[model samples]
Target: MTSDQLVAAPETALPTLRGAVAGLPSYVPGRRGTGADIAALASNESHYDPLPAAVAAVAEAAGRMNRYPDMAAVELRERLARHLGVTAEEVAVGPGSVGVLQQIITGLCDAGDEVVFAWRSFEAYPILVELAGARPVRVPLDDSEGHDLEAMAAAVTDRTKVLLLCTPNNPTGVPISHGRLEAFLQSVRSDILVVIDEAYVEYADAGSGPDSLALYRRYPNVCILRTFSKAYGLAGLRVGYAITTAAIADGLRRTALPFAVSALAQKAAIASLDAGEEMEARVSAVKQERARMAAELAAQGWTLQPSQGNFLWIRADDALLARLVDAFDHAGILVRAYPGDGVRITVADPASNNRVLRLLEAHAA
Candidate 1:
């Protein structure tokens, strides 16, 4: 090829040469409701408004946008350490739990490594593993619609570098039993990193779930992922963290994007931790709604797994599910439909929850 022709070709294909991002699929977010008086229950975000103190904290930090945030996130880590009863060096903060998961994958895996997780748990897990050039091994959930810890443990091989455990898993909302999870952890090799994602832990059954923080202390290779987006009601601020050994925490800090957690996010998270009591109350309300929704759906003959999280999954007939979603849209009430099988209905405020129940009852009748 002539030099002039090569030069022209390079300029023409500039967009393709941007990076190795060509293979990555763009993350699909749940639809937002901008229409007048729409109730959006797509994403499993908390319905409670941010505490006044947290709002003020974020607003105050917004003024310092001109200055760069702390690269190491020292203060935020300190607060999280106190909250988790760990040392500051054992905590690492990120933009969100998703970011933390990505960083963990990057730090541990390389090309050809394998990461194991339950199928249909979190949409991001496989994507993140592949993004890091690692293989994704997905184990099918048990018949009860929860992570089959035994199957997950069996799926692990020598190539397995990481295992992601999302308790009170998404869509299904059923948690793996405490004894089952501990037994699974004991089964896995010590060299493999286990990430226990507790994004919805606050809404899970009180004594049924395992305490990942406690497990982390017992197992050096374990990491606990937590988020402010769920019960804390700080999804907009985008702050989450990992509690692990100091060595794993250091690896995450080194590989994660610098200053990904903003000053406002950090400050707001601190305030949220301080307002823990109020958040606990909100979680209680969501739990009550979850139970109510489950019982109502079960009695209506919709097949459902027992959900311990804020959302309940209903296996509806396709035609009925589609019609229900369309009717809801017409009424300005939005819920998430998982393409072929069923719809996941998250519990909102009393009024919104009642509206949803009434609509379902009318349609079911």
Candidate 2:
């Protein structure tokens, strides 16, 4: 054969993506509602701007963009270690909670392995499991739209490598109780990793949310996932971390993409941690707003599932969901709607919150 024929053969066709990546459903972000008048409550982002401390930290770190971030994320991990009262070796830092979760899946699962989780929990769980070449075993949520931990336990087989529990579950806004979570933990095998995603923990009513750290202390297999994005108002900065056994943490760190967490993100997260009092105050405000919204929604003749997260859930069969979404869009308010399941409306500022309430009331009347 001629040299030209050999050289051209390699360029004739582009390599195709893996079936998993190509077949993966597109992750849809919250719609940026068209104008200033629009209330975009679709993403579950904190209603407030970044904390002053975080903003300042980001500005300071902006000048250092010329260099790569610290791959180990030593300072941030050390600070998180101090905050959580664990050794640095037990903490794993990543770009976001979802990123850390991806690392967990990669570290634990092999082709044909299985991972168990609640259906209608975090949407990313199944996708991540599939990406890792593992089979996803999803157990349906019980009638109250919360996890049926017993069913989940039954789904686990010897091949199960991971289990995920997203407390105050996304979209549904329902939290698993302390008693229930403990019981579930007791029933599960010790070697399998149980990831507790507490991304919305700060928004949960203190009395309702689980004291998961206490459980983690008791259960060596439990891995607590958290993010600076939700309550700390650092979503754009993309910083998250995990608290788990040193063995599991080491695996996560090893699987993480090098320099996944940026310097600016690290600085902002540390500053957010330092400003805990202010963060708590902001959380308190959101709780109040949630209570008010719940009361008004009930008065308007809607029976909502009890919400512990920063969002409210409305059960809408597919047909109803389409109409409701249309009406909401026309009114300049954006909410996340699950095609056949429900709608998730974030608790935002007073004006935006009131706007939503007013519209719903009008519809009911």
Candidate 3:
């Protein structure tokens, strides 16, 4: 056809996204605040500044940005191995625990394979699973807002490849106890990979959650995922890791995006691990704040599940949720709102926490 005729004709079909990608729900991040007075209690990020050593390390590593990062993340892996008492061969470092989890899913899951997890846990769980062309099976949380391990165990089929257990689960902030998790592990098939995501472990009180390392030692199928973003104050840098068997860890490394962890992030993570004591002190402060807030909220006649994470979960129906969302927005405070579930307010500094308290006090029954 002539150029004019071809131009008049319809263009060829444009490239389209895969069905899985096209149908996937976008992960909604917490709303960021612009005003100085706005309290950012949306994301469960540490309200404190990065550890001094981490900051220093990032600054020092800035000069080396010209070179690509260690693709294998050797130093960071070795450091993390030492920290977790695992061999370097059994450690894999990625951009964040979420990133490592993506690697895990992509490495293990084939098309149509299944991954089981608790609903209202991490929002990323199903997203990652679907992106890997795997089916996501969600087991609803129990009455206490913790994982329904029995249901999760029962959800598994021969096609099931992975199970994600988020301790002190996000949004809800309820933890899976050691005994329950152990029993659940005993019930599941040994061939399936079980990932225990502990992004908020630093904020959890001792004995409140699973001893993941011990569980890993007992079950080769166990994988422990963690991040430096929360309590270590390295959220901006984007570094996290996983502890798994040597073969599986190696496979995850292969699946990781090349140089995904920047040199700055690697240095910051190493330095943060080195400053463990200082990080622990900060975590202790957050825990204290969390307890104080919980106690005050209880006294206010708002019964709540004991949150093991660094945030508080207020379970609300649609009407109450709308009121709290509006009030928090009007008061220059940002928090995470799950439409059908509840609102999660990060336990920030005393002032910010007080703002949340004042807002909730007005709405409490």
TM-score of 1: 0.93
lDDT of each: 0.85, 0.91, 0.93
lDDT measured at residue 122 in model 1 versus the true structure, 0 to 100: 83
* Residue-pair clashes per candidate: 0, 0, 0
Model 2, 99-140: lDDT tens digits are 999999999999999999988878888889998989999999
TM-score of each: 0.93, 0.97, 0.97
The segments of candidate 2 whose C-alpha lies over 4 angstroms from its true place after superposition are: 1-12
Q: Give candidate 3's whole-model lDDT.
A: 0.93
Query: What lDDT would candidate 2 get against the real structure?
Result: 0.91
Better of 1 and 3 by TM-score: 3
lDDT of 1 by residue, 1-365 (tens): 87766654454554453233567666756668987688888898888899877998989998998888897889889998887789999998898999999999999999899999997788888888888889999998788888988888889999999999998888888787778878888899999999989899989887767877778878888999999998999999898999988999999999989889888889999998998898888898888888887788678766778887788787666887899899888878888887665778778887888788878877874
The candidate that wins on lDDT is 3
